[model samples]
Target: MNRTKLTPLDAAFVQLESPGVPMHVAGLMIFEPPAKGGADFVRTLVSDWRKETRIAAPWNQKLESPSRWQLAPCLKTCQDPDLEYHLRHLVLPKPGGQVELGQLVARLHSQPMDMRKLLWECYVIEGLAENRFAIYMKFHHSIVDGISASVLLMKGLSDSAKDRKTSPFWIQTAPEKPFQPASFKMPSVPAMLGAANNVLKLFGRSDSLTTLRSAPRTPLNGPIGAQRRFATQNFDMTRLKATAKTAGVSLNDVVLCLVGGTLRKYLQGITALPTESLTAAVPMSLRAEGDLSPGNSVGMIYSIIGTNVADPVLRLKKISQATNVAKQQVLGLEPEMRVPYSIASFAPAIARMLTGVSGKKKPMFNAVVSNVPGGRDDKYLRGARLLHCYPANIVFPGMATSFTCYSHAGTLNVGITACRDTVPSMQKLALGMEEALCELEHGLGLEAHANPRSLDVVEAAL
Candidate 1:
């Protein structure tokens, strides 16, 4: 708190306002309450915050780390009533369905979190599908991301239904461990000087050249709108995984290929898909070992997902290769290598700021696709069973469609969030994804891994 620096939490606002951006800083969590106690779960979280000042902002004004961030609400409360932070509280609306709860979540996201304090909120949802309940948390783009959010929520929730009745589910992560340290031990004078020299040397090089190489012009990235559209889909992760294994690619690659295939079919002969591999900004987790909390612990990796290829299986192969090459390029760079480029954001010229704010950014990637790996087993809130968890991601302008997938217990839930105006037929795209995925399975000669019966339920609803 004593450190003077512009924290990553604050920088997020600057990133959000930028035009031609596809990323949305938000997350959704689903919970199944045990038969006996649910209120205690909420009570525990509130009590934990009271004991520690968890709200903070990153002090690395140098911008060395993303997760090693700071928070707000530093002053301790003097009164019990006023002591409670309204941002953290209980939400029990008159009995309504899970879809109704979704409507409420949508409303919360329509408004941005205020930077004056802790820019995050948590909603305790009841009346969910089946007997399960849900908890939805929204943190500023500057703070926690989907991966960190998942880790923190798991620790907050009960390991067993009986555990839900107890308070202090887990210790809080305030003053969380920094996202990274230069090293475990002090380096020799020569080594330290060498590291510093490397940073200075990179700064000496033409920053504009490297930054320009990363920026690509495409239809995907642009200014986002205030309104967001939410869609949910379920895919057989097992089938997808098996297909990927057969193809010697990753689940992510398979999914990326699916996006390309579906888009090609949907937009065939309309705009002529890109001839080269399409790019994607992959958000990688920066959190070290056990330091997980409710704040941003993420960084960006510009990836070129292969949409240039036409064949489904061939596209998968190309995507996996392109991603490997892109990640290698980024990883090979020094930590401070991106500093000069980020500094360009603070340049004073109105033309420069306007350029970052309003123009159609050169395509860094074709679209944004992220897959979060979660539990493949079922979880309970109190006594109720969780039926489904639908995700609604934030939407910016040009890059309208964002896809996030997570699995819990035995089910894989995929959330497709986009701009209604841009992806007007996103529901159809969701269906197309299913068909594409099946086509992929067929391509790999795998029939045993067809979609589950639940696919019927989703298709019927459509």
Candidate 2:
């Protein structure tokens, strides 16, 4: 723990070789407290964050090998507020609610996290439609992922709001002990020779890097404008699952198909779009059950979102095909290789810092559409019911939009994050998502709980 070297996960975050890459993933929540108690909510979160940081193990230590990674936490219950930042939460002007929320989110996408501290932030926003409020949090993607992220959120919320327990998040229930990084074991002579031979073979074959380079040169891959856009939507997971089950696929396949339908409709709104399906890069977590002890365990797949197709069921089939191909490509990559190339790792930290000072090029995705797995169990906070959890991911150039969902209490909370100015009428994209979900449900002859529409989608375009 005395060293200052980057773990593989840390290296991925610092050396963002990918373009339009979001540094961290975040979740936005709208809470309806019974009454406004000044600083009560903030105090609760600060207290929780204080306890959480005590267990946060930084990735500054050496590992037994490049493949092994882990994090270590201190005992005696940490109370370090320095581990997190309390961003100023500004209430929007009159009538400015989700509209302004979208604006702030767009601004956030354009900014980058500081490398000096662990990348994380928590904001408490006041003045929603009425007495309700909101909270937004961002964390470096190198840590836990969306599903793992939701687990942390659920854990923070008390099962009983009035339980009045004095448990430190740093200390686990039935606590075994804090984890320490395992020692690194250098490869033996035979293993080293094998890896060296594989590298030479790959150099001559060029099979691994071709699929990544084959990404078409679109506006989504080039330089980006500073201005951003935001869009969101919520859908019925029950319906999505039913459709996916009927199609002999997964809810993920359903999401891929539905988004394909939505994008095709969106393009038709603009003008005649290409017949070739639009490509999307879906990130895949490489974390095994025992891997989350340290930093990031992740990779990505580049595949066609299947946007050009016109049929829902047919589109689902195509999406399934593309996904299989993409997954195969990712599996074919070298185990030690990361999703984004790490050429910058060869330079000093300062040199790597300079790359993002202005902007780095070489984006790999037109738009990212990820479907994170979420819990199906119901969860709550101190008396306050956990209604919804909206996710807002950070943005990079060429790729300004992304999608994610969390399943809690038999309901699916689908979240969207996008660039404001660059994307056209993103709000409708949100509404269209509802409409698309409904269409999907209706197509499958399944029942839905409600037909609630996503806030005013049309007005936002103005």
Candidate 3:
């Protein structure tokens, strides 16, 4: 059996998981039916995946003695996994549509993964209104982060539409030329001292230190129950990119603007709009240049998404400025110094856990907004064309809502996951996001020909 040690970040994810909060990241992929309709496509795909009894390295591994270690967890691989238990098939009731699919996914996501077996599962769903099929797959946060998960899924897909016979990710074998694993060595005393000194220096920075303080509480920040609600919407990538170019801002800036406007409208409707701007914990990828290993390599930085602004264009400008400031602060720090900075930011959460406090009084951030870069190339799984890809992120005790956007195949897919009680009207929020985009398009004087596709209608229709 192969054994490996989990990093500190990975271990924290495992320890932080509770019955009410399952620390898992998942994705929903909608696909068109296969062109050749001779047999059951899903059944054939599952049969092909089950051909190989030997599971891959990380997928075959499970936590070993999880509660024994406080800082790090160890993994042990099982030579063979129970395919019947890991792979599942489900069918929706009559008149199956996006609503039914969203409800089913929310139910599936509510259950935490069993630590005794592999930390992932795949569900093939059928009975959509348009004869479409869906795939819902989830992995524990400790196993893989968003970027790594996207990469893993991309490996199973083909860049060309003609490559219909390509093998799935589970059945594919490791490359013949294995990457050389870095040798392990103990850090020198001087090196350790220097690292500690750098961390101390970061704490000395007034801005960095102030960021550690608690953010003002909002309705979205509180203790979360086990139930969850999921909603999704899509936007045209070309229009967003064009707006960003015209505004001299980044694509992420445009996304945050939409979120800010939506949150503002939602809060106004509920009469809980905070006078102060809302803060978001934006997760930044920390993977080394050209490094694409399957593990967690990310850190979070807080940004003030100007939800208090009344005008959409003004909100966009403020968001752009705030993101720029946040980016500059992060870029100014040395690469080695950033890890300690991130760990230090989590101090408040750790303190809450130790003190047995629920943290409803003060939240670290109102929500999490993340933008994951998905390649522009059209991808295909077996012979099915990928329609939309939505990401489902985790929600913790203090943070009840999270937003994740993935740009895939010339479209930007937005996913919102929230606690059922905290955000009961999530579908309204999803529709509001579309409206925010439309407002931006009109503000820019490009509404007549802004989106080539009918994104507004399609997003709400879904």
Give lDDT tens digits, candidate 2, residues 17-123. 23355467777766665443344664564455455533433222222232211342211222243533534455656555667877776676556655444445667
TM, every model:
0.69, 0.72, 0.88
Give per-candidate clash totals: 39, 13, 0
Q: CA lDDT, every prediction? A: 0.52, 0.55, 0.76
Q: On residues 22-57, what C-alpha lDDT tens digit does candidate 1 reach at each position?
A: 223555565555555455644554565557433323
Model 3 clash pairs are none
Could you tell which candidate, 1 or 3, scores higher by lDDT? 3
Please give the distance, in angstroms, between residue 16's alpha carbon in candidate 1 and its true position after superposition: 4.0
- Please write out the lDDT profile of model 3 over residues 267-366, one tens digit for every residue: 8888999987787888888776665666787877676677888777788887787677666555656555666556655555655654546545677578
Q: On a 0 to 1 TM-score scale, where does candidate 2 land against the true structure? A: 0.72
Q: Give residue 271's error in model 2 in angstroms.
A: 2.1
RMSD of 3: 3.8
Q: Is candidate 1 or candidate 2 better by lDDT?
A: 2
- Highest TM-score, which number? 3
- Model 1, which residues run further than 4 Å from truth? 1-10, 14-24, 32-104, 166-171, 178-222, 269-277, 331-361, 375-379, 384-392, 448-462
Clashes of 1: 39
Candidate 2 Cα errors over 4 Å, as ranges: 1-4, 17-22, 34-89, 92-96, 164-210, 213-219, 328-364, 442-450
Question: Which prediction has more favorable TM-score, 1 or 3?
Answer: 3
Model 3 ranges with Cα > 4 A deviation: 66-70, 173-214, 350-358, 448-462
